[model samples]
Target: MMRALRALVRKDLTLFFEDRRAVVLSFAAPIAIGAFFGFLFSGGGGGNAKIPVRVADLDGSSVSRAIVAALEKDKALEVKSATSADEARELVRRGKATAAVILPKSFGEEAVNAFFRQTDKPDLLLLRDPSHTAEAGMLRGILTQHVMEVVSKEAFSGPAGLRSARQALRQVSEDKAMAPSDRKDLTVLLQSVVNLQEHSTSEKTEALGPQGGIGVPYDTKEEEVTAHAGETYNGYAHSFGGMALQFILMASIEFGMGILIERRTGIWKRLLAAPLHRSTLLLARGISGALISLAIFLVCMGFGMAVFGVRVQGSWPGFLLLAVAYALMASAFGLLLAALGRTPEATRGLAVFAVLILVMLGGAWVPAFIFPAWLQKATLLLPTRWAMDALDGVTWRGLGLASALPAVAILLGFTFVFALIAAWKFPSEEG
Candidate 1:
């Protein structure tokens, strides 16, 4: 029985390889698609693409100039100076810029006073293109960070910082040894510090909601933890992972169609007339399909690494385990389709449609993060999601073997279930 199964598997493999078009389509198509997406997302070379921002500085004050200078310094922004707010707005409306920042008259004075907590915050107008909301949001965040930096430097500097300055000024105001004029000045300074502190506290409270949090309110620091030193994020890693999974499904469908073709041509009947057992025949087909899928996956990923810089940053062993498990699952799925499908043409069409739906819901074309929260939760039931996640974990996420085990386990479970269904429904010689 083992010899018969091995011979059947070898025959299938030989037939698959003889079709050069099939081999090329299974391997090359995925790599090509993945490279296109990688280049699109990473700007071809993984450099940051700057968002164009038009600034209309009507105030011409030192503060406004300083703000413009800060904007220019940001790597993410391409700052353009405009003579008037109208001009800046026109630029945004015409899609030349993402947003228009207008610094109104007296902005410098109002902004400084606001920083000292002695006046209302300046109402700078931010006119943004409706179509570029993401860019506008990013610009807003950058503007907020710049303002916070300026305020923190001015209000909390020198020997008289936020806490110490308020304390020192209060002590001077209460001292009878000081002149009335000096005491009055000290009192005013103390009030400014007190007001700023109170405002800051109130803002923090509002941001934290009713329940206070343990972490810092304003997160200015960012730290990247990588599995390997000097290793950076590769956009191709995600693109390739998704593309490979999608194309593997297509390959699986083709594998199913092969079975359908054999059945239509009476090849199954011829094989049954031989010494081969039904169970052995089914196992042979499953093994052949699994081997083909595994080879295609490895070739696609290899191309990704060599051409697009994708890497298995975590455990290579774990990554290999995931690849094998997913390939087996895909093979079993193909066999199940073969068992359930009625005719060759109909089976091919239905299998393709089902594969497309699986890919769409699996987050193979887009990041799962973009999905609605509920939909994201629901996608957890999909085998493709587990496969994609496992690939991501071992590649860009830099997760270890331990982290990939659950996904591998889930894929193997799916394989077992699919194989059982295929076995139960497999066409017999008697039928």
Candidate 2:
């Protein structure tokens, strides 16, 4: 049985290697796809890294300059200075920039006066498309922070702090502690000075409830530095590499059914007459199927490295072990399919639907984290999940062999179970 399996596997390997298109589709296609998408994602889809933002300031004041400076502080944002509102809008519409900021002419003056009068706050106009939500939201945050800071500075320095000082002095004068008019005046004057010092330098003072106390300005230097540290690899390539490894495993179905075909064509009968046991023939085909899978896996990985800048930070031995285990499992599944289906049409149609569904649910198209709770739990029973998890461990998670042990073990278990099932229903000859 073992000898016959070896012979069958050897023959399959020979056929696969010799057929140029088979070699290309099984191996080259996945690698090419992995490389292309990897490059796209690693390079940020080849779009502009800096978010182009247009700024139109009718205020033409220092306040506008300060706001622009604050926006520029965020590395993700790029301020394109515009002289008019029309130009800014045109820039946005033409896709030259993401969004535009339009400051009203009386923005600063109204904000300052509003603070003095304790009235409504000034408003800054934001012009943007609905499609640019993230960039617009971020630009709005920076601008709002700047506006609040400006308003706070003006309020504390100009009149708000002054009013609080005088009110406190008036309370002290009315305390009537056996004081003459002239003496009360002196006390009020002294109290006013102390109040000014306390309000103006609020860090040394305690909170004054809902009225809000004056405070030193907050430092946003660290926030600006960490928000965008350096370059980022693309998501497109990473996803492509993972999907390629996952979907290519489906080739096992073809190889398995090819065995049944050879039997129908009398090839298997001739091979069986060559002093090869039936079990040996099956084992050889399994080994050959695994080799083809591993070959495809390696080529895809190589493409990722050469084109997409993906680095596998895990143990190479561990990765190879997982890959071989997954291949074996995929081969076993194909054999199972062949054992179940009595004919070629049945195998092809059923295998395609079943394999595609498993791959889709197994995080081949989307990450499993986004799946529902019950679906996530169900994935533990699926070999594709283990395969994807193992690959992710090597590529993204920086995990070694130890981390991939669960996945490898599960794949091996599946392979064993599948091969056993196939053996139970093993066909004596193709019908």
Candidate 3:
């Protein structure tokens, strides 16, 4: 029994190695995909991947200017200037910036008053898209640190420091909210701050908090912005987009493979014997394949919507247009694959590999915005990328048909090219 088993294993190994294509694909596919994943994910980490942010300094005070400069100097932030809070927020909504940090009018004055005298904390609006929630947290932390530092320097060591110190001393004495113990502590701290001005102009003063407490000066009011003003983000919209695109394309590949199988089984020979031209036969296959893929795509999206509350938040017309366009493109892609494919055994592995690469670059697994700046721009060349964007635009982005028109046009263009090439290559007996 052992001898027979060894013989069987050896025969299998020999068969596998005899087909050089099989041998190469078995090993090369994994290696290639692994390397590609490593390259793609490398963009997510490291110092070079900075979050893009817009800073709107409505308060043109010296303190606000210093804070803006400090934020600009940070390695983790790519800062741009904005004229107003609305302008900065618009950038975030449009994806031009990851977050918007708006220093409102009187922000500097109010912050200083809050710290020295017990006024309401100054509000700094932080507007961010829902997908960028992680980056928003990072920005808030960064802003907090920078604001505290800037406020501390201004309140304790700037030309107005002595004045703020005197103001704090008087306010501490008159405050009724403070406990006796806390008031005593604040009195000593304030008096010492006042004495510093008489001794040395350059002396550093410890930052004061409202009511003599220790804290950041400004309050961050975060608003999670979605595609629409009232609508919440539906994560399923994006996931469905990527997953449907992938499976529909896979189904298209199956349709293409069917042609090759029919040829092998002599069904294609009988079809070729008919009076219909090759283009006519090929177009029928393409159309049927497109309809099938579109049906699959719609079924999946319907499941997502019915179960997960995913809505077409944008234009319904745009959503349908993109979905149909992608279905056609995917069918064409399948034809191209069939025209270029060898035997089923040889083509399946290579086709899957190509599909995986397309999906990876198309932001199927992760948002393309998370990639480094260059990779984000580079994905624009891919049809899968356009498909993903168009799907998102019509779903979560609340964009109209005009916004999706470009993607629809591109998908159709790719479809035309794929079909033209497949027809040219279809007549050849060679794979």
Highest lDDT among the candidates is held by which one? 3
Off by over 4 Å in 2: 1-237, 429-431
Q: Could you tell me every candidate's TM-score relative to the true structure?
A: 0.55, 0.49, 0.88
What's model 2's lDDT at 111? 58
Q: Which residue pairs of candidate 1 clash?
A: none
Error of 2 at 304 (Å): 1.3
Residue-level lDDT of model 3, residues 40-156, one tens digit each, is 567533313678999999999988998999999998899999998778766776566888889988887677656665568899998887776778888888998788777776676
User: For candidate 3, what is the TM-score?
Assistant: 0.88
Candidate ranking (TM-score, best to worst) = 3, 1, 2
Candidate 1 residues lying further than 4 Å off, grouped into runs, are 1-219, 223-225
Candidate 3, residue 424: the lDDT equals 90
Q: Candidate 2 residues 14-51, lDDT tens each? A: 87677554454556445655674454345433332566
